[model samples]
Target: MTAGGDVGGHPVGPDVAEAAVPRPGPVRRFLLRRPGLVDAAVVTVFTGWALLLGLGADSMYWLHEVLGGPRVLLMQVTSAVLTLAGAVALVWRRRRPVLVAAVMTVLGVLSLALTGATNGFELGVALALYVVATTAPPRTLLAAAGASVLALLVGARVLPLARTVGAKSLGVDPDDADAFAAVTGSGPFGFATSPAWFAMAAPVVVLALLAVGLGTLVHARRQRVAALAEAARARAEEHAQRTRLAQASERAQIAREMHDVVAHSISVMVALGGGASAAFDWAPDRARAALDELVDTGRAALGDMRRILGVLHDDDGDGPAGDAPLEPQPGSLDLPRLVGRARTAGLAVRTSGLAVTGLDALDPALQLAVYRIVQESLTNTLRHAPVATDVEVDVRRRADAVEVVVTDRGGTAPATAGPGSRRGLVGMTERAAAFGGTVEAGPYGQGWRVRALLPWNEGDA
Candidate 1:
């Protein structure tokens, strides 16, 4: 078979895998897909061709006929039958390449012995040798090749043919000559030129070796193609896995952003609206002022949402944005605004070291984490704790870390806001953990306190 055909189960080379190997065309691929059909065709064609060559005049085929002598019908029939058997053996050559090669070589040698020539059937042995070379181990190949070459020399009667041809040309009857069949009155190795039979058989021997070499090349190329295809599949799978991880991480970050922006903005707005409603009847101007604060709070929340959504839109080319320019997230500089919002929401918010010491010098990502932590803490207080609650936000920046502690004194009861999803605390915890930090949230003497400590990264600093 040609190199375009499949060896074992590896499809030789499809177009994509033909980086350096020759790509099999449509006809070859179709034949390769049905190896059984290909084998049957090859066997049939080989049997036909070899049998046709056997139809020549003399029963001796080439040797005696070319030397001008005897013919035998029984010997000719025997050679034909053995040639047919060798052709049929080709059907199983792929399954048992080494065994088939040995069988065909023996049959060819027998044919040469019985008919005085191979009768054009030695090609079967070469075909099997090719298959053997493709699949066998290197040592096995070397052994098989050595055995086949030796068999070829013996079958062609290398010494006998040379001697017989030389004796015939010198007017001696080769059939009556001795084993060496040397020229009349000449020593065994004294022939001046190469004999005719040996000259013809030498090319066939060389062609047999070439068959093995060609098969080796074909096998090597098929292995390379299979390896390339396998590597490509692994790379594609890895890329898909990376894509999945990136998408999951992005979704989680978006969830935290949504909770921080929407939850905090809504909680503060709810507090202002409730205050405005409570004072609407008792104090008209104060209620009007509260309503103004509520409107400002809503607008600011809208702007923050736009910015967040805009970032999403820029990244994925989707989502709503009110043309808010892409800007960095709120960091240490934005904490005062956060505390001011809580105060305006009617919480008695106080501060200690809210100013940045080395916070601005830290990683921006870490700063964002700190900001989210503080924002979530205050949002929980405004929604869960009573209004006019006394809240103390303590921020301390050290050489290696920044700590944020927001604690609120309990009021008479729960605030006007409804129960929360409690996702804010989870967001805070996740944010801190990402930056190698920690958060603690629970009841502190009948009040709620949320503490977060974020470290300064040496690389970021």
Candidate 2:
């Protein structure tokens, strides 16, 4: 909303936000650049010729006398004035094209009837019809053009021939009998060899059709331009929508990483800290060892936390990751360290078949799923199974799957951190599910059990 051109909370560039209007095509740009000047120029073209032709028409005295009216300038001057007035309507042709065209047609008919001659207002009518054609729909354009042609033909051909015959029957003076003939002889409008109805009708129809044809062609080009503009806008909006979805998915991934790193590390440190404090009174040596273990646990947690956070600082891929320490993806190689951490936190863990062959042939994504499942299961045992003395971690590789099972003997333990949020379990299940795997977790006798199956193709394995 600022003068600097901001739209919908985004700072649009100066080149883009010029007036916040839709971009203009060639025809529209011309009219929009100087609308008043364009209107004035159109009015001048029509009005200038109309006024000139009005001045050259038969004298008012001759026209009224020959048409069997009074020998005054009443009808002649009136027709001239009406024709000039219709010419002024050309200025507004673009804004009210059909209305202006209808008005001009009516004025043309009146002028022909009053003096039995055109005052060059047909040119103005033709221009108005062109405007109407450019703006009106196909059906409307057809109707308006048809009506205009019929009215002009009646005014120029049928009405004049009838008026002349009436004037002759009324015994008009012989000297003024050729009024209609003289009017159509030659003037600003092209000359007609004969004043007969058919002679006049042909020109009237041709002019009207020509105007409509030009208008229709312009409208077709304008429509094509408008359609292309609409398509471009749709593509831009789609791309923006895709970018929003990508950002949302990335944020969710960051939340999962933070939870996994913080929960496991913090749980083990708290248990070590508690044990050290409890033994300081009676067993000084034991307390010292516990404190030392607590320190070591804190350092390891800090290192893991740093590794997890290093991903947030974008590296730009030039070389170093902003000088932040790099870390490898956790996998089967880290299983021994993981188990050691749980043992340090006072959990007795037993492993079987930890060195499964062909484990290295697994895809990184599948390996990641396996590692997170085991880590989350061990963290759950440490937090919820304090009374559990034996924790078993079993790894087995079959022809088409890698299976992991973690179980504790005594699942019942006094709660140290109230209730669980259950996000850990959800994260584990989600990771396994990403690679078409499944996890089943529930109670097994007095202890809890978590079993995971990550399927793999033989070619991939």
**Which residue ranges in model 2 land beyond 4 Å of their true spot?**
1-30, 57-80, 117-120, 161-199, 281-313, 316-321, 458-461
Model number with the top lDDT? 1
TM-score, per-candidate, Cα-based: 0.72, 0.78
Give the clashing pairs for model 2.
none
Residue-wise lDDT of candidate 1 within 300-381, one digit each (tens)?
7777777766645545534455357567778888888988888878888889986666667677888788788888888888
What is the number of backbone collisions in each predicted candidate, taken in the order shown? 0, 0
TM-score for candidate 2: 0.78
- lDDT agreement of model 1 with the native: 0.72
Across residues 1-461, which tens digit of lDDT does each residue of candidate 2 receive? Answer: 34343436665443443333356779878887988988887787777776665555443445555555653356656766886688678877888988898888888787667655556666777888898888899998888888887787657655643345323334344347376455344343423443444444665677787888999998887787667555545544544555556567667666776777778878787777777788889998877887787788778667766666666666665434455466667778778888888887788999976688778667877777777788888888878886477899998888778899999887455755667899988988888787788899998888889999888887666
